[model samples]
Target: MTSHKRKTGRRRAVIGGLSALGITGAAVVTATLLAPAGAASAVAAWPQAKGSKPVPASIEFSGTYDGKLQRHYGTGALGSDGQDESQKPLFVLKDGAVLKNVVIGAPAADGVHCLGSCTLQNVWWENVGEDAATFKGTSASSVYAVHGGGAKSASDKVFQFNGAGKLVVNKFQVSDFGKLVRSCGNCKKQYPRTIVINDVDITAPGTSIVGVNANYGDTASLRNVRVHGDPKKKIKPCVRFTGNNTGKEPKEIGTGPDGTTCRYSAGDLSYD
Candidate 1:
């Protein structure tokens, strides 16, 4: 399908329900902020869906698709929230596509797939299936941006970086998940991955925030990260692994900021 470009000088559309409060970004800005030890921060409340829609097949979207805070769930062939690796996504975004103000419901399948550089703005996942979203842009310069939006109940991963490129996630919240972002561990072809996460809220009962392949020279930069519930700091901030092209499970090397692979300081993270 042909993908289009967003027109210049166009006013940004209001993310339904948040429009009245002047919250123009991907998430709802709440006055109650989580004071990150030494870092500045603001927490967000999850947006409520305006309605719900059932998707039977992957909807190929380009340019801009505003869901108006509607919940979209998989059905028929797209139905299934198992650990199957072959699950189809509810939406397939072409290069330069923008999917905004959307909420993915249960039986989410793969949730969303970005075939190339794309922006997922203010997109929430009520119950992530398989994974929330996968980045498949092959170009090193390609960028996958997830701005605003919160995800909960992700069994394994929230964002899967399978292809080469940079992933920027800002103003996001996640809870009850395994890993927030994971670089391709055993993809037949691997490339150095870059991840930037800022102003994010992470609730406990989670594993790690970001996992990267140190062997592949992947890097993850985190700032203004606030953790809730976990006082013992059981949730790892960053995890490093020696990834391989073979399908076998990758070997975990270590965890925490190495200043190289995991770029962050003690001030960059705080718990409450």
Candidate 2:
């Protein structure tokens, strides 16, 4: 692993999302942005785990694990050296639980992993490996129904709670997904009245994040988020908004025009 021990480290990295329509508790039509919360003072970066040699068989998803250990997970397309697919992402939910600033290649086939129900303030998303989906804290409940932002089998989610969970994201993003779709296409709750994104950034190939054939209506608060993070990686309409799409104006705060979405993967995303 590449550990950059910061002895009074000069600076740490930070990374830093949305959308609308429909009126169903389905998340059947919504979007999200993320912020940071619950992380330790020091964020640890793990080297990309090795990829499957000949591509593992398409694994099937069982369900959630007991309490919060984890049930099933499929490995994402990784590089030989075991790094994340800079282009794609890795399946981490079942394989393991990622916490605070832990770099990921791709999330699980269903969505991000949040084992136990917990409260979050902020989080982030980054694209440092070959190509993968970075995490940004959303909620503390059940798994979310993640969708293919642009790649294949990119639908999956992670949760940290039980019962009718609620996801509250502040900012979100997707970088270098031009040829694929345009951005992290879909992120919703499977059951009705589940999770919801507050702020967001849809940026894939189609010019937007949510697919034309989706209905993930989010009803959370939101703020300034982007599809890209730097000038060199500039796309279009870097930020987005996905207010209480459920028509209820969710519980949210603010962080407008962050202006730092152009740090080229060397920054920490703040949803906190």
Candidate 3:
């Protein structure tokens, strides 16, 4: 556990898109882009959260989003960490809730938190403060075609998966963050923490890829994932796996532009 804490703290400081289609809603909340010329436009059509109630349907967001940052949702259980009205996340998808076509602005910590079976599609996060997004608790969830510009600091990561069941992240694009993806799992639970990262593109000149990590007997698989480092910077390997690492060893498939391949053993992986 000492190693775990030390690695977690060290990893803490270190680590760590979009798409298209339909618009269905009567109340079109038009919003302008704070972006420069040629920047795409976005709008928020969904209604804001009224108290502690989840919206009946999925939320499709574009442009900028401020969750009010009035409350902090607990780590586990929808309200497990403790239900306080401190500040709520932008959107808390109830079981089966989906958050798509969303782009988070900078100076924000509360992005999207998933409780149970949920899907996050076509989501883009830019300059996130802390965790751009998270998949909390032991549930089956998937993040599809997500993109992240970077994080506010070098200590924050782009995404975290703390669930015990199956978690799939497909078509993810990110750059300039410490750890690209992290997982802190439970040791006592027997359920496996299976994480599959497919079609991922990461460009962290001096950062660590730190893909899927399960300390307590978990497994991670990386396929068609590419990690690029700045030619002039000193960077670590593309993937790092720590902890007891007693589960199935990590598997990485894919190569870098310069013929850099992934080297995987029990605890570390260098994917070029």
**Index of the highest-lDDT prediction:** 1
| Candidate maximizing TM-score | 1
lDDT head-to-head 1 vs 3, winner? 1
lDDT per residue (tens digit) for residues 1-272 in model 3: 99889755643332211111111121011101122212222322222322332332223344333344222222222321112324345566655565555444433345566766556655555554456666665643332223212233325566665565655555456666776666642223334455555445556643655454333434555544555555543444434343333454344332222112233332222244
> How many angstroms is residue 107 displaced in model 3 relative to the true structure, after the best TM-score fit?
2.5
- Give the better candidate number (2 or 3) by TM-score: 3
Candidate 2 regions exceeding 4 Å error are 1-98, 105-112, 115-164, 178-190, 199-207, 210-222, 225-272
lDDT, model 1, position 150: 92
Sort by TM-score, best first: what order? 1, 3, 2
Q: Estimated TM-score per prediction?
A: 0.86, 0.29, 0.51
lDDT for model 3 comes to: 0.43
- Candidate 2, residue 83: CA error in Å? 16
List model 2 lDDT by residue over 1-272, tens digit each: 13445411211222211223111232222221112322222222223333322222332123332212122223444232223323233333432232232223333322233333322212222232222333333343333333212122222212222223343333333433432111122334322223333234434332322211112222222233343334443333222233333434223222222333211122332322
lDDT of each: 0.85, 0.28, 0.43
lDDT for 238 (candidate 2):
24
